[model samples]
Target: MLKTIMLALAAWFAMAGGGGLAQAKGLAPLAPVAPVAACADLARIDLSGATGAPTRQEAKSVTEAGAKPYCQVSGTIAPAIRFEVRLPLDGWTQRYLQTGCGGLCGNLRIDAGKAEGCAPVTDGSIVLASTDMGHQGMDTAWGNDPQKRRDFAERGVHVTALAAKALIKAFYGRDPRYSYFSGCSDGGREALIEAQRYPQDFDGIAAGAPALNFTIQNSFHHGWLAKVNTGADGKPVLLAADMAPLHKAALAACDGNDGLVDGQITDPRTCRVDPAVTLCKGAYQPGKCLTAAKVEAARLIYQGARTAQGQPLEVGPLQPGSEMNWIGVFVPMNADGPIMSGMFASDTINHLLFTPNPATPYTPQTFPFTLDMVAQEQPARALYNADNPDLSGFAGRGGKLILWHGWGDPHISPINTIAYFDKVGEAMGAPTRDGFVRMFLFPGMGHCSGGDGPSEFPLLQGLMAWVESGEAPAVMVAHRAKPTHEGAPLPADGPMKPPPGATGMPKLPMMPMMPPQPTLPPRSRPVFAYPAVAHYKGTGSIDEAASFEARP
Candidate 1:
């Protein structure tokens, strides 16, 4: 009887074109399996009069374990926003993921979905998508086009999500069960924009190190740092070598305050070290001591960006452990001019916010850090900043938001994220806010990832478990990557003896002695939600998360 039923169902599927057939002649209706689209057929999928058109589509077979074949579609949406989507050919998990891009977002990066070890499409289980955020490359010339600027600020990601979902439906014959957005830095800004401007676009969002106050951060703050570091002769007061002593002084003063001498400062807000401590008492020494001007510059950076009236700006001070990373911003390639931050500020101010024209010549010297300058940029701020405190619409619809920031982040201050989280809590009330929103502050982590501390964690899994099973993460474990020595051996003066056990005909030469690897800190730590601290338990291996407890 079972065999006969199977045969009848197969016959019905064949006749019904893989669709359910209504009961007839007293035979019960048979459910049908949805037809899956072939990889190549996805290329022919029409998106005209839709969100975007697919310019290229190809299928590739992945060799990763448990991975299935998938289709990759790349194209441009309205206003020339470039995008790409990857859909699994089999074993669809009924989930869709939209990844965010970083650092001006001129190039497409689909792998942002797997940032910090969160892999949603590991086995072709989830559809993954990414966009170039409207423009291509680091050049902000596209800002001259209002439509492109609008796309770069927010529309690009939203349209990409819509177009991706439409493709998912056309290829799978079903809508996704869930949709998520994940990103860091500018990508994080995009995630917040989705929550604020288009709540319905995603069910869960994981944002890390978001550059929310985009206009102000990239403009005034950048100019302020450059101005403070510039000497009387218009040269950089602080050189790259001066950072080591500053970092050492900071660590020496604050590293043990957390009841552990690990490299991480734990909470830099509590650190009160004076930068003047590194100032030279006598002659100027290159690496061992900082000049008076350089010391003042470092102090200004740590004191945070301030207005002429001495009022604190939106951007926070650099954390104690972020000195090493500051080299990239404070040190110029040559004696003549601006560093990375200065160049970014000059480009943004001249091309994007202030003039929005490439023909207008503007340099770092042209931009001034003043209240008037800040006032002039308000219009662009409104267009770019994602600092909205309200998430009621998102929460009411059962959306989950996971915000994480690296305390050691150098580009955008982590305190900005904390301030934003606090604002959201105040606006929505703690009880209601905690229901759908959580923030994680990773100690010693830098930018999106990588630092002297544990940074890797499966954020996607945490979001899914919270959204699907209502299992909110009380503490997420972040892993510190082990150090590697994969490159060529260090230079040596002459050949050295081989290993004792070696029986080669000729003695093998040994490379120069390499410096001892720095002792790694804790391998993993518990990352708790905002307002809760991860305290040491005082027992067991400090490297393990088991030795930490969450406390308010």
Candidate 2:
């Protein structure tokens, strides 16, 4: 109790005055406490409280190829919230990091996403924990159970944090100096829900492409994409081959709009792509042109979900530049199997989004895409959606939040993330929001990482700097092995020379031939804070991060 009170006081001072101001307030920094018990003894530690009791299954030493040596403790919170806690054997930094899970999230994943440059993670100086969100599989079958659903919604993370902290204290004899949460995609949803529902759980949070506005996104947005691509005969209107041409066309129209012809639309919102560009003047040619049906399908998808009266049902449509990602997701690769959006929409509607009514399993085709459908989502939204912008509790405690989304995200539209950020500014007041909250939209990046853009950035490192030192990130440098999507490796032996009679231009310059410039494997670029994008300075190589500057 004394220790808890002392830690709370320290946190309060830290929040109130940051570093030097806390000293001016006459408060000394809290000293670290050494381990009071053995690692294995944590198995018997009591974590019972208002939430419930935890059942320990295993507590032992763990050492993997890439990971540092640590004590791996496995346990379950009340009603089967399976969790794992990793305590560093040495170089403990008095910090706790909890990672969120992706998709249905039934398996434990201890990875902190995009942790480059984060000292605690890179140096293996922090305690880490993760959970399966109370279930055992990557499906929505467990949603039928009310307690499990509740656990998956919010309780699981909170309980896991509590258990991890209790175990941390038992082994280290004191609470961590700071706690942080990081996640992307559905895990991003989990991160936001944690901040909204349980503010004190972490001092800093980094949510990437978070699935906020859950009920509408899962039902209306995902469902609309699936249903729109299906023809009257229940066949896919657009195939994988059909999607390439549209993306190619979109690129041709807007790739250079940002003053750089770098195969990526920096801000897709400003780019308007007309589907007619890909429309077949005559009969359809697979990768060159699209038939009217396919063109209409692409147009409708970019137009987004709408009611019969034409009112928009979603935050916004998938941006113009993201059309290529629709191949395996919105459009089908073949004539038959389910697309990605259909699978997710079906799972959500049939099991998780609505109260379990196993008798009536809903699919994209079966679910009604209307305002009534939106109204019916209130119950699930209360538990699932983290759209509430009132993050006063979190901000009040000096918690720092970093919300990032890929501008070219195919699954969840970046517009949704922008909408939420706008709401936060409105709810908390722009000044207050600016103090603790920051949003970064990575151009050409997909859901979490992979896309045409340089999605890899130091998210954890930036969040830590903000939380620990009050240093807000003005811009983040991102990188990719191959700078642009146009990069395709040549033959291993050597660059292929075209036949002498070939009509097309050669890969190398025909006149004034000189050695080709060395291709830099990893290309670095900058992504600025929200509403600001990286603009090329025109004189320097666009591939280099230093050549670009942040502009609103």
Candidate 3:
């Protein structure tokens, strides 16, 4: 009975003391009680061979940055988990961190656990960050080593959250009321991993163009980088050069489907143009027409990653509408068309996929995962497969998950994400899935953050609002025609096409990349979670989410 009351008092202290300014008397005091029991080492977080100077300061120093006073902190070890705590001056804002560490995440730059630069954690809320996912050398590597995995209990992502929260509690003398997460690529997968395994970790999450399905996604990259090429005698090269004409055709077919065709296509599903027909037959600028060989090259991309048996290698959607970037001259895609640069698939095969492991340095019996054979290998399937469909933990904790992918993503496919979401609906049923989960398909974007559109929106804001305020993100605006879309960085030679509907259409300040939806005010839509389907009036089988109701 005494312990229960103490626990309840602790909860009150956590929320009321987030800023460490609470004056409540009933709440228990916030402090780390080093265990009197000697079974565990509570002095510091002891890691393998971990010996070093502790915190920068002999004593704790609570400093403030600008208007948002914060708790600047470092763990007991010299370079132990370093972080900053920013608390809102308003009606208490929640704290969260966006993670980016993968493979061997070591250098803990003050960025938002994920973003490269220090994410000032700038917002109307308190945000936290850390870099303890292991990895010490360049790039993410420590994540795969068994010894390191054992030290971490083979669950690195979980530690990111656990450590972050611990830091928050210590620095601010309080616990966050609502927690949220947002990230892309490796970060994206981390977001979903938390939802599936630790639903109570974050209340709401936004995973953009996630590099989920670790094994297959990376493997597929290897297969494409190794197999696809564009040389006269079947050599590997990037498709940038040929990508121009391909982009032109893709736009021609799917541009105005959304109502406008300035140069973007919102719904890539409507695009069915085949670049094969648009090859060198026509006069395309001075010596710029597509050759028969180049035409075939474009066909391969649209076909996506494949395997030895001619079976489709499962993949995910590229960020929505990300294909218009023919910028910079190189090979099939780039104008310079350097041999090394052109072989994108080859590069992936060598670097990310086939790169020899230096730790053991023993050559694997099989080195490359050809698109045709990617699925056959578990390691290869990890790259971008998105196969982990279960999210019971997230559902049980009332965690809201929002994932969006670009239909025309050139780098990563969006179809895989769609497939994963579909499976979630099936497993949990439309009723539950519809409430906790939702996916927004961007018309033209790339990878996770940028491309030929307005990739930056109030994504973090929208997600935070949903988790903290009970308001969900129903309408997300992604424009490929942002004023800065012209990555002036690329040489003028870098090819680019007008956004969809740019076809002698009415002019608007914001370029029309695709047909516009009804100029409707912000709309409210339910996020259909898995296990529970959105019951609706439809003429079809009700047993399956696909047949039971129509997606709005």
What is each predicted model's overall lDDT from 0 to 1?
0.72, 0.76, 0.45
lDDT of candidate 3 over 350-385, digit per residue (tens): 334332433333111233335434534445434333
Ten contiguous residues minimizing lDDT sum, candidate 1: 486-495
Per-residue lDDT tens digits for candidate 2, residues 1-552, read 223323433464467564211111221133434567777887777677624774554688777677778888888777788888889877677889999876666666576768876767876778998888888754568988988888888888888998889888878978899899998877888889988989999999998888887788888998999988989998888887786789888899899898889878988877889998899999889878999988898888999999879999999999977765565566666677456687778888888877646477787878887889888888999988889899999998999999998877778898988899889998878888888888888877776875667878888877887787766665678886342222321110111233353222134311111112235456678776766677887777777886875565
lDDT, candidate 1, equals 0.72
Q: What lDDT does candidate 2 reach at residue 29?
A: 33
- lDDT for model 2 comes to 0.76
Tens-digit per-residue lDDT, 1-552, candidate 1 = 223333444464465475332121221122222327666676676665466443333444344455555677777776678788878766666788898877676766575432333344454567888988787766667878888888989999998898888788888898888899998888899999999999999999998888899998887677677778887787888776787788888899998888888777888998987889998999989779988888898888888777768877655866998776565455643455346677667777777785445456656555655678778888888899999999998998999999998887767889889889888989988777778888888888777765677877767777876787665655567887554232212211112343343211124333222223355654888776666767787886778876776555
The candidate scoring highest on lDDT is: 2
Better of 2 and 3 by TM-score: 2
User: Total clashing residue pairs per candidate?
Assistant: 0, 0, 109
TM-score of 1: 0.83
Q: What are the TM-scores, per candidate, against the unseen true structure?
A: 0.83, 0.86, 0.65
Report the Cα lDDT for residue 101, model 2. Answer: 73
- Against the correct fold, how does model 3 do in TM-score? 0.65
How many clashes in candidate 1?
A: 0
Alpha-carbon shift of residue 202 in model 3 (angstroms): 1.6
Which TM-score value belongs to model 2?
A: 0.86
Question: If ranked by TM-score, best first, what sequence of candidates would result?
Answer: 2, 1, 3
